[model samples]
Target: MSSKELTDKLVAAIKSGKYDAIICNYPNGDMVGHTGVYEAAVKACEAVDECIGRVVEAIKEVDGQLLITADHGNAEMMIDPETGGVHTAHTSLPVPLIYVGNKAISLKEGGKLSDLAPTMLALSDLDIPADMSGQVLYS
Candidate 1:
């Protein structure tokens, strides 16, 4: 589905006041990015940016928190510096881990995806399971 359709649905769902947590993925950034078309990838990124702005506004309106992150890095390294050609491979760069509306939270260095679960549970005032190996980033 297009990013617009997905974004619209996400906004609607957030405004409905029914869900405690929601996950929205915008695959265009990676999917179009992998095609090695620079212009199309730029447009795809712009669309995702607009969608994220909309979602952030919706979350703030409902006094809800937002945890924004990515599974991996794709568009960050678009072109080879030496070759000057389109590079189509995921990078080892660290993906962003943003926490909106949660001023008490602060991420330390060496954070991994496994830490997300514990951090999320802590943010919601829930207990982290003993078996979970991730450390909570915030109280």
Candidate 2:
């Protein structure tokens, strides 16, 4: 879906309050980055950022919190240092975990994707399942 559509849905969901939580993933960056088209990739990233800004505003209106993260790094590193060409492979680099709103969680560096679930549960005061190996990212 387009970033605008994603933003509209998320804003509606947040405003509706029908669900306790929601996860909105913007695929533009990742989808466009794969083509190695620099301009398109940049635009895709910008679109995602714009959507994020809108979503943040919507969530704030509801006094809700937000957790922003990515499954992996892509458009963030668009060029290769050696060949000076577009880098298409996914990087091993860590993705940022941004917490927004009044219920912001304290972040610890060196966190992995696995840490997200436990951290979300902890933030919501929900019990972390024993079978899950991931630990909370915050103190």
Candidate 3:
């Protein structure tokens, strides 16, 4: 779907009030960036930024929290100087994570991807599963 269509759908979903939280990973950045279309990849990133802005507004309307993160680096990044191209394989590079809302859900120092599940569960007053590798990040 076009970016406009996707954004519209996301806005509608947020306004529906059927869900308490939102989690999404738009594939445009990864897919377009992998194709080596630098211009298209940049456009995709811009689209995602606009869409996310709208989502955040909706979340604010409902007094909800948002945890935005990625599993690994794909877009919003550049080719490693050593590699000279987008790394065809995953690396240990740190990904970006943004927490928006109350201070209660803020991350403690040195949080990692593993901390996400536990933090979400804790925010909802749910017990963290024993098997989960993440620990609740206390701010």
Q: Give Cα-based local distance difference scores for all models.
A: 0.85, 0.85, 0.74
Cα lDDT of model 2 by residue, 60-108, tens digit: 8998888898889888778988999989877778889898867645789
Q: Write the per-residue lDDT of candidate 1 for residues 1-139, one digit (tens) a residue.
A: 7899999999999999999888778998789778888888899999999999999999899989988888788887789778999888776788888888846666665678889888888888889999999987654
A best-first ranking of the candidates according to their lDDT comes to 2, 1, 3
- Sliding window of 10 residues with minimal summed lDDT for model 2: 98-107
Q: Which stretches of candidate 3 lie over 4 Å from their true place?
A: 83-91
Q: What lDDT tens digits, residue by residue, belong to model 3 across residues 115-134? A: 99899888777899899999
Off by over 4 Å in 1: none
Off by over 4 Å in 2: none
lDDT of 1: 0.85
Leading candidate by TM-score? 2
Write the number of the candidate with greater TM-score, choosing between 1 and 3: 1
Clashing pairs in 1: none
lDDT of 2: 0.85
How well does candidate 3 match the true structure in TM-score terms?
0.82
Clashes of 2: 0
